[model samples]
Target chain A: SQKIEQNSEALNIQEGKTATLTCNYTNYSPAYLQWYRQDPGRGPVFLLLIRENEKEKRKERLKVTFDTTLKQSLFHITASQPADSATYLCALDVGFQKLVFGTGTRLLVSP
Target chain B: GAGVSQTPSNKVTEKGKYVELRCDPISGHTALYWYRQSLGQGPEFLIYFQGTGAADDSGLPNDRFFAVRPEGSVSTLKIQRTERGDSAMYLCASSLASADTQYFGPGTRLTVL
Candidate 1:
């Protein structure tokens, strides 16, 4: 069976530091990977997307790295703030306009 | 422009009752999707529609669940004989195309007692 795994269920980081979240998958090769941030009682919002051929993508203080060989993707938030605290999800494009998402990892940035 | 929207922000129904959840996609978006998210879990795909046709319904859990997109704009998800296990947040999303970024709505939280 295909599976997607995040390194941890919850992560706590100090403010002004870099927070890295990891997503690993097995038994699938996706053309693209996406990251989303979701807050309490709300829907998730798109953050960034990286294609298989591209190694890294960045927007402002957010960065994402895709390693196809290892079937892993890393999401990094620099100079993290409490405002960035939320559950982060990784989605794999399963072709034909479908996406399979991992359980997600909750991130907490402490003051 | 307004993003996607879902009706009945919350619904509480008894088991075996029928329910309908509605979704209004963004203007001119050609692709729309439905997903279900449980507590502390990521959204799970239910179905996808392109224009007025259902492009994929593979993720639908069973025959008791169905969705339709009429006139290529609004869609509805219908559930028959709701059960306690059916309780979850029903999400709706829309995109300009299959490969485009999807925007989600506030979601309809369903609770079956």
Candidate 2:
């Protein structure tokens, strides 16, 4: 079975610092990998997507990297703010548009 | 444009009862998906529909779960003989098309007591 793994533990960072989250998958040859931000009471919102052929992708202060060899993707948020505090999920997109999501890593940015 | 929307933000039901959850996809979206998220686990794919047809129903856990998209835009997931183990947040999402990014709804938190 395909599986995804995130940091699992919560990551605490000081405001304005760069916070990095990791997503690892096994037995998945994903054509694309995606990152999403989810608040406590709300559903996940699209963040960034990086393809297997693409090494990295960036949007605003967000950046994503996909390494097929390592079967891992890393998400970075620079200039982190308190408002950025939320749980981040990584999804591995196999064919047929199905996604296997990781447990997610809780990130808390404090001033 | 308005994103995906789901009704009954919260539902409390009794075991062995039946429950229905609805999802309205974004206009013109060709792909609609259903997922379940437990307390600490990530969202698990339940089903997928392309237009009015279920392109993939393999994610469905058991025969107790079923879904339909009669108009290709709105879908309903019906669960029969609900069990306490069925308690979870059911999330609906839609994308412009399959193989594209998906936009999710606030989700319906279903609890079976």
- Candidate 2 lDDT, tens digit per residue, A8-105? 89999999999999998889899999999999867889898899999999999999999999999999999999999999999988889888889999
Docking class of 1: high
Per-model DockQ = 0.85, 0.89
* Candidate 2 clashes between residue pairs 3 or more apart in a chain or in different chains: none
Candidate 1 TM-score over all chains jointly: 0.98
TM-score per candidate for chain A alone: 0.98, 0.97
Question: Compared with the true structure, what per-residue lDDT tens digits does model 1 show for residues B55-113?
Answer: 99999999999999989999999999999999999999999874558899999999999
TM-scores of all predicted structures: 0.98, 0.98
Score each candidate by Cα lDDT: 0.94, 0.93
